[model samples]
Target: MASIPPAMAPSTANWHWKNKNVTTWAKTWFERELPTISVQDDGNEVSVSEVVDVDGDVELGQRKSKYVPPMY
Candidate 1:
């Protein structure tokens, strides 16, 4: 009797779109596009309307940005 081959493990490897990691590209795009899309909040009260700071590791695919709302 012929032995059946071991079933292939299911993974993203077969997924065509998953082959390419877009995280780096996406992060770059955001950095480039953020300024163009950002709007200034010129209101009477102080508010956080823009990205004050961005800190993260591109290699680790980690990012951190903070935006604090106006206290009412």
Candidate 2:
């Protein structure tokens, strides 16, 4: 009788979601949409907000953004 080899784990290096590779599309969309995003504070008169910091783990789908209101 012949012995079968153990199965290998599936590769997720190029996967974005369930069996689909949407990295390119998602990345492009995120880049385009990022510039249009704005964070505003309702308590104060925040006329404009500038992106002070941006950091996150893309693979984990985690993102953080810090906005600073301009000073007169």
Candidate 3:
């Protein structure tokens, strides 16, 4: 469905990804919230400083079409 000149389109056949230090979106939250997530003694011991529970609600509905077909 796209109409464009071939010369203007960027070629991805020879594209090479570069290694860069990209920051993660959840890195800050993990460090601040789950700093105590670790194991000890051959992964036999575990600890958690805090725990959080989330709750939510959702509603569903249907509406009739506003358009009416013209009477022939």
Candidate 4:
């Protein structure tokens, strides 16, 4: 998107041109952009335990829980 004019601040209504059709332009641009990120985790087990009542119940704002390994 182009920068907003200095004298006129940006508002939700006029952020971008509403009538102009830019569907083709957007599709073409994204086709060239490649995603290059990958995530892998070592073989490990994570355990989460409840800290309050084992009955699986707690009042609002009166309950606390934590992960067993504390890293997950």
lDDT of 1 at 46: 46
CA RMSD per model (angstroms)? 17.4, 17.8, 21.7, 20.6
Better model by lDDT, 1 or 3? Answer: 1
Of candidate 3, the 10-residue stretch with the lowest lDDT total is: 58-67
Worst 10 residues of 2 by lDDT: 59-68
Where model 4 places Cα greater than 4 Å from the true spot, the runs are: 1-18, 35-72
lDDT of 3 by residue, 13-71 (tens): 32432222212323434445664676789659776665453233222211231222223
Top of the candidates by TM-score: 2
Residue ranges of candidate 3 with Cα displaced over 4 Å: 1-14, 24-26, 29-36, 40-72
Per-residue CA lDDT of model 1 for 1-72, tens digit only, reads 223223234454443222223445445555555655534476544433454555553321111222222233
Ten-residue stretch with the least lDDT total in model 1: 59-68
Candidate 2 structure quality by residue, lDDT tens digits, 1-72:
222222223444424322323344445555555566556686644332343444442222211222222234
| Candidate models: Cα lDDT each | 0.39, 0.38, 0.36, 0.31
Candidates 1 and 3, the one with greater TM-score: 1
What is the Å distance of residue 15 in model 1 from its true position?
Answer: 7.8
TM-score for each model: 0.30, 0.33, 0.21, 0.24
List the pairs of residues colliding in candidate 1. none
Task: Give a tens-digit lDDT track for model 4, residues 1-72.
Answer: 333212223345553432323344444333333222234569654443322312222111111221122122
Clashing pairs in model 2? none
